[model samples]
Target: MSDIYDLITKRMDLLTREKEVFADNILRSSVPGEREKVIKFKNLVTHGGATPKAQATGLKSTNKNHLSLSTHLGSTRMTTKKTDSDVSLSGNTINAEDQLRKINDATTKYYEMTSLYQSYMRRHNTVITGR
Candidate 1:
């Protein structure tokens, strides 16, 4: 169903954005007065939430060993906000421990979502090919 695929794609997009934000936050943890970036999904609902269709003009990998490049689907749904927790001694709002934990969580969610997508495709293939 298109709706199911759209939902899964949106969720994966959100997770990807979360992971990126968390990674960035960890990198800025040591910088003085650097506020951590966070992902806010509430506004995404109002912001055209549709996934942009992929362009047909991109380069394609013609060989098994060819390097594959990733494309960003659209603008991120991330928003910056001050952390409510205590800032570090260096005036950085990012806590490395928290960022690491968030990154792990996002990674796990992404993996699960991908697995589900794969399972769906496998079933679809089986039905279509009768193999």
Candidate 2:
């Protein structure tokens, strides 16, 4: 349905914003007194008389060493905040390696959403067109 497509587009947009922020941080890693920006997602209540909520299922990290990915579940927008990462001798709060890792994660998520969108389109077409 159109709702699914809209959701996919919105999520892709969020990932794009995330990538831009991480890229900006990487670019400013050498600048003094520059603090890294982090994007956080918050839950919002969509008023429709408050129907009973269903249990949410999502990916979880089983190992302590595994890299944790942001879910951004049920979030329509993101809020940017200064990161608490330790600053280097140059007084730059951005860690290039960490930024790169975050960028990679965002990029991965973007592609995954793209793939899901394409798959949904295929299914939709199949349903509509007797193929």
lDDT of all predictions: 0.72, 0.69
Tens digit per residue, CA lDDT, model 1, 1-131:
76777678878988888888899888888999888787555545443443333223344446857543323334345556766578778877778898999999999999999999888888889999999
Q: Give the TM-score of candidate 2.
A: 0.68
The local lDDT score (0 to 100) that residue 59 gets in candidate 1 is 44
Candidate 2 wrongly placed segments (more than 4 Å): 43-85
> Candidate 1: where is the Cα deviation over 4 Å?
50-77
Estimate the TM-score of every prediction: 0.73, 0.68
**Top model number, lDDT:** 1
